[model samples]
Target: MSENRLTNILVPVFAVILGIIAGAIVMIVSGYDPIAGYSALLYGAFGDRYYIGETIRQVTPYILAGLAVAFAFRTGLFNIGVEGQLIVGWLAAVWVGVAFELPKVIHLPLAIIAAGAAGALWGFIPGFLKARFRVHEVIVTIMMNYIALYVSNAVIRSVLSDQGFKSEKIHPSASLRSEFLQSLTDYSTLHYGIIISLIAAVVMWFLLEKTTTGYELRAVGFNQHASHYAGMNVNRNIILAMVISGAFAGIAGAMEGLGTFENVSVKAGFTGVGFDGIAVALLGGNHAFGIILAAVLFGALKVGALEMPSAADVPTELVDIVIALIIFFVASSYLIRLVLTRFKKEGK
Candidate 1:
């Protein structure tokens, strides 16, 4: 690999290693056995077919959520409202799935599309305000999160309150469940939603790397004044980027609504997936393939953490500390690069 490529790959790997080392030190200080803890973690993640499937299932939404954040990041935006967008998207998809009566061919796709549309519409507002009024997107998106949360709760209770705080189960026609796949994994919730997430990743890669619009978005992101001087419509691109980013987050919610949960409930607070996505994006360097790897790693850590308390007598919160450290190292890429550069110079 070229030096830059090597750096890109090594930086994240180095961060992960550092995080594990830090976690190990903490474990030792707390009188826990780090080796046993790590061993149990590995066993929980991949020692069985069921665990493997569950790990994949958990990571599926992280991929989309990470992409949502990364897409916005690519276009000079920080879509902090991904949590709110995801909530609305889940509500929209479930609403469509339960309300519609079309054939599977039409119904399933419609529900997914509806979720994306809801997210896009949600994202567009902040983008429009940023483009037109020069309002900061972060502030607007933060406000939108609460609005989406309360509005969704009220709408669900008013319309789909057959259950106490949740909506009715969605129609089978719109479900992404796969009996064959479930059977293969010994009845885990691993569904065809993974296929959608993978396809979306590929699509994201193609769009960003090979398309003119993608180039324009990146250009504006890197230098909005320069892009404007080049005759690119910076404002339009900003809105488009946010809309697309929100659409990705919406589909992530679809995975939960149509595949894992099969129903929508009133959320007590923001789903941590969107917030976790920020970490994933940072760790993955905002690249499509990197995002996939980061999501799987995160998924494995999450599933594996459950086993830590019982198997190794270690608190599951240790895994959270490791994750935070990893994110910290990833975010401080400049430090890692400086160390590498220093080593290279000394070697020369």
Candidate 2:
């Protein structure tokens, strides 16, 4: 492999190892057996076919959410409002799914399209602000997230209030469930959403690798002034990138509505998945395949954590600490390498 490829692969792998080691140290200090804790965690996530399927199910939305953040990052925009866009998309998908009486083929695609459109609209706001007014995207997206939460909840309450905090269940035609897959995994919630996530990853890779539009967006991201001087439409690409990113995020929300939860619920704050996407994007180095692997790691961590306390007397929160340490190590990889070099020199 080329040097850049080697670095990309090794950096994350080393970070993961360091994080696990640190977590083990913490476990030892707290008088827990690290081996038992980790063994239980691994078992919890994959000991049974059902557990393995559930881990994949949990990862489905995360892949799309990470894609949303990764896409925006590649295009020189920080889209922190994915949570808000996701909320609106969830509401839109659920509304369409519940209202439509169409056939399965038409209904499912229509609800998904509505979700994407809703997310795109939310993304457009921040993109427009950045392009037209030179406003920073991060602030705008953060504010928009709460706006989305409150507005969506108010709308759901006004219309579907009888359901008490959740919208009506979507029609079977609009659902993403797959009985075959469920049975294969002994009745896990693993659904067609994973298919969607895989398709989205392929699309993202093809777009970024094989398209002139992707090149222009990347050029603009590298240097907007240079791109504009070279006759590229910088402002247009900015808006387009956000729209596409938000569409990915919206589709993630659709997974939750149609696959996992089957309904939309009123929430007081952001969905944790959006924030998790940031970490996933970072750990994945903003690559499509990398994001999938990162999402799987996170999914395993989340699922495995549930069994830690009962099986090994380890707190579930320790997993979060490990994740945070991993992020810290990844971000500080240069320092890590320097320290390793020093140790090698001393050994010599």
Candidate 3:
């Protein structure tokens, strides 16, 4: 058991090391100082309280998005609709946020929950189709993504357009601000969403590892046929998994709008956070704690990359390249496993 655990940890670590080595080689070939560039990257990400706060801000949504993908993955589903769900969720949340006037406590949570419901409804269509008509989830999810983007743009134009491509700002009551912390941090964007995200991670971990529903989901994932034979409802589980996944993704959108942007803008384009969640989930090996760690890493990279071009003369695009390389190495972990096995055999 210890060896298995060690192998699992080392696999990801090795992947990261190899990715860094490959990135360094690329930097050298491009006539950049790899060491200095990396030093700047590290400093930019962790050098100050301001940067760290920004990193946490960026990580907030990533946690939800990562959980969305990881949860679906656990149930043998590939929910490519997270992008669409997030978009719709953002639109719904901000629409309600601006349209309502209520007490802070009631307004904020209600708008957020509305976002989750909207996202779940969007995901439910694909789930229904798959469960009833045997439709391929991959194709349905991809189509839903485009539909969501275009539909959202049209809604924004029709409903919120004041000759611009943006919606009205959310009501102050609906906003999730931490005035005390903001004052201390000089108005940094960090908000109460971080606490919500942490709670979500813990809840998801418990649901997946400790609950009977989790066992059913995993059993269905491992063998749907066997699950059905054992009196489990396969179709119901599939739909439930997708709905739950979409709900998490919706919360991601809510976090972005309520906590960060304070409103949804069609011109902001898709946050692509759903896609980024794929990388986070994969890099974290789909574990809840690992997902949090991975989200922070990616968040740090994003925040740090902004400072790179100005401080270290390295392009922000290089950071993307590094991330891609890391993802590639992670996806091909068998290569590292083989190498490790060879080394062990030789040593023996």
Best-performing candidate as measured by lDDT: 1
Enumerate residue pairs that collide in model 3.
none
lDDT by residue for model 2 (84-203), tens: 888888899999999888999999999999999999999999999999999999999999999999999998888866747888899999999888988998998888999899899999
- Per TM-score, what order, best first? 1, 3, 2
- After superposition, the stretches of candidate 2 with alpha carbons farther than 4 Å from their true spots are 337-348
Considering summed lDDT, which 10 consecutive residues are worst modelled in model 3? 263-272
C-alpha lDDT values of all predictions: 0.92, 0.90, 0.87
Give the lowest summed-lDDT range of ten residues in model 1.
Answer: 155-164
Candidates 1 and 3 compared by lDDT, better number: 1
User: 1-348 in candidate 1: lDDT tens per residue?
Assistant: 599899999999999999999999999999999999999999888879999989999999999999999999999999998888898899999999888889999999999999999999999999999999999999999999899999989888888784369999999999999889889899989888899999989988898889999999999989999999999999999999999999999999999999999889988888889889889988989999999999999999999999999999999999999999999888887899999989999999
Write one digit per residue (lDDT tens) for candidate 3, span 1-348.
886777778888898888889988888898888888888888877787767777888999999899989988988889988989988888888988999999998999998999999889888888888888989888998899899998988888889667568899999999987787687566778888888888889988998899999889988888999999999999998898889888888888899889899977775466779899999889888888889988998888888888878877888899899999999999999998888878878999
Q: Is candidate 1 or candidate 3 better by TM-score?
A: 1
| TM-score quality measure for candidate 1 | 0.98
